[model samples]
Target: MTSLSPAPLISLTWTDHVTGTEGYLVVDRLVRGVSSGGLRMREGCSLAEVAGLARGMSMKEALHFDADNPGARYIPLGGAKGGIDCDPRAPGAYGVLVRFLRAMRPYVEHVWTTGEDLGLSQDLVDRAATEAGLVSTVQAAYPLLDDETGARRRLAEAFAVTVDGIGLDELVGGCGVAESALAAMDRAGVPHGGARVSLQGFGTMGGATARFLSRAGLTVVAVADVEGTIGNPAGLDVEALLAARDAHGTVDRGALRHGDRELPADAWLAADAEVLVPAAVSYAVNTVNQAAIKARWVVEAANMPVLPEAESLLAGRGVTVLPDVVVNSGTNAWWWWTLFGDIGPDAEEAFAHTRRSMRALTDRVLERAAADGCTPRTAAHALVADRLPVMAERFGWYR
Candidate 1:
């Protein structure tokens, strides 16, 4: 029996308040010659928390690549994550971020490729380039980010204000959330064509999810942004709302109509819907509001949207909460499919492959979870954990 625990290859910590922050760079595994993950900055972030996130990235990449295949021509990259405990909006935050990045350049240059996570944006990337003189390397690394393009471009454009020549491509990440949500709905015997769905958080993840799910014919009855939650029980115009969402995914209150009601924070959770998507941040479904959650399924579009303890309670209540490790892996799968897979001249064809691969991956994970009688999160982790020995043997990690 294989136990699912985060066995990180290395966990490095630094406490340099002189640089105005401290963080951890946890490299969970190395598949071939490389590893990849995100870099986030938020107050109270810890080494252990980043280590856990790195493990999730490891599971995400392994499952997306069909690690169990053993002989597949996978990308051979592992999972790594870095983050600092600080506010990104503070007066000296930019200086602190640049100093931190300069200090970590040796580790990030090759061993661990990182991207934006949580509070840190492309501004950090842009400014870090000017301050640390690593714009060329960052330019190459950022385009590899398949999902969340809008956010990245915004960050790169933030570079235009003070710097020159750095560019970013457009990307988004919620297709996997929609696909996995529908896959889970399919397994749970729910009708997606007319399923009532509500999303909390209207950022790139939630916005893209609303777009895809709505296009698939699901009724998005409610959506919440930073300002507040707004809904129309019949359905909300997802595309219009997506276009209307601001830089930070704040939807305009004035744009909502058709008997729309501005509900309280808990309204999205309690919406009379079949699915609830928490695409904002971790611990969205905690003990206090977990009880009010009426949806039959909870799809985590954001990383760790549902905490472990709250998840147990939801399971007891019969709410099937799909884990981010499986549900929100569209971003990783897109990276594997686009930047990594064999490409032809057709852009649409490549995108089609991405969609098919994502759907298949989600379906397989859901199928395994059902068969194993474990949560999808646990099942996905098991799938990755089981392949570690083979990955080591193939990639020569231990040698």
Candidate 2:
């Protein structure tokens, strides 16, 4: 059974009255009357982009389903996504966000549960949601919880968790990404000790990924932020750079050491590294820039960071592109895992669950790719194809 339909279940567009900015919400699928995804704010976000992201969310949700494991409590929701076409750093951006939330509040209260994505943060989203008079971003899912109060408390407690000054919510996704990369290395027989990585975008996902991978013995040779690219052939200090980042993930240039060399922004595409992570904007690695990449693996830490044509080109050159639907799904899954009682509100438990789940999924995707002689993304789609039918049969598609 195919997981994708010709079009989304529902799509809405809103225009902010004050700033004339545009916002979009695409509900690609619905299970038990609700869907899950993130709300991203950026200058050029469009309906088409949000639709693609929503569809990806659906696949991501289905890929994590272990229907055989009856003990699992975290049932994957349907996929959805929200996007706003306005720069988050622009003047009156906050006001625009509040208005967008207000306009999208009905969907939030009834069908779609959202959090930070791309150019926004959870704190910012939560604050704006409150200003929009909403109960919570995930209020739509309250009906699915057996103990709503306890679930809310558990989620709140989990969000309060901090390991070495970083929030657990922020670290879980990165943990998943790092584990996936490690799984790929294991499949290829590459030692982690001297494996090099270059990352684009040092925000929540990128910064957290750098931390986990660096701690796991991978040398982060270059990291790109809004300012530019910072490189150190001998490997940069991951912790120091992470500490110097802003909420939007831009690193403070003042924190660079003498040995650190500044390179052009897109130079990260060509860094001498074993792994390249595009954790920033969509279509970051397009056909033109894909030629510059020399990494063995392109680990997608962001949604649709590598264009399809670029991925095909990379594949022709023998580069493996780990699909984002599987690679960067930890953060979304972690929220449900904690809220639905599949896992507790502790850092170790969260990390353990994310690692096990992501590694297994990665291995399965890689193995499927090998067996079918297809790309990892196609293998992931094949996996989703098997599970989405079961979810629909059990939950009644639109529920």
Candidate 3:
């Protein structure tokens, strides 16, 4: 892990009187006078977390755009994230969301274009935008229909294209997690069907990755949700677990029939698996449990999933880790397509392009790491950061 670096460019906080809650907006960097990100509202969300996420988002932009294609017009927006603390299910959540958006009108209009995250849903974003007089047409929350299946059905009726399945693959970041993980396994000489995987945080990101990895023939030996971890020496049934997941992406422990043993909350770390994915939250694989992780690869499917010291420890122990910026980038690619693609007739081409872009970049990072004798995280940091000085020089933004 590297030493600490420069702090964020701006950090703003305010209290929304309507919700009686605090809101934080952290701008990690400003590229070309713009920074765009989501407005998440998970319980216990904090300013530091928002800043860290903004930093990650910034790195994602750095890694995605470069000299060859440049794509300067739309490729890299500055990195920022906004968040609030409040129960999304509260009866007055809409009022709180409206007030929160209104309070941040200046930032939203001039600094960042924010979307939904965590507890912030599509309906809430739309309602808030209308009430706050901000344009609601562009806010993004996946499967916006609450019922993805229904949305697909409606799309099929309106458009002549084929829309298949519930289409969680529409969730770009989750798809990226599986793609990067599989690519990492392939680099390690683990064949497509040969790797065994374990995952923590069986929510949207984790669950989507599990479905993808399992479909691609990986053995998911252990998975843990908020309550506890479950394991089986042989692979667990990904289909069953997905079917059992709650609306919030949790799988009830009571629904398990195949997992041979139910372990403590942290036992997922000790699973006899080849790949470990911490998809739940930050500080999950830290000093306390870092020593116990047995996986050959730790793919961070969540932003800021590993602390610096733990990442260093894992590297010292010869466990390779594909950083979150690489493994958790599918959604970023998806968003680019969503905003820019001409889905009328070239939709298939658009998706194909997204997948290829995600894979090519991930492969580039992995290869560079192999040659440089550093962790993927380190290699990715250098590879992406090297571009900034040039960008700053040309853009005249950094002093």
Q: Best lDDT goes to which candidate? A: 2
Task: Write the residue-wise lDDT of candidate 3 on 1-399 in tens digits.
Answer: 121248888898878765568889898887656666767776688998899888887788777765676442234556788888776767776677788888777767666766656665444575787789875423322212244444334333322332233243334456678888777777667886767889997766787788778878889888888768888878888778877777556676666775457878888898888889998777788877899988898999877888999989999998888898888766654554444332222335534655577678788998888899888988888877776666555553322
Query: Would you list the clashing residue pairs of candidate 3?
Result: 172-330, 172-331, 173-331
lDDT of 2 by residue, 32-137 (tens): 8999999999999999999999999999999988899999988899999999999999988999999999999899999999999999989999999999999999
Off by over 4 Å in 1: 1-7, 15-19, 67-74, 122-127, 135-172, 344-347
Better of 2 and 3 by TM-score: 2
| Candidate 1 residue lDDT tens string, 259-323 | 88888866898899999999876767887789988899898887777879999999888888888
Query: Against the true structure, candidate 3 has what lDDT?
Result: 0.71
CA lDDT of each candidate?
0.70, 0.94, 0.71
User: Worst lDDT window (10 residues) for model 1?
Assistant: 162-171
Per-residue error for 41 in candidate 1, Å, reads 2.5
Candidate 2 global lDDT: 0.94
All models, RMSD in angstroms: 5.7, 0.9, 5.7
As for lDDT, the candidate ahead, 1 or 3, is 3
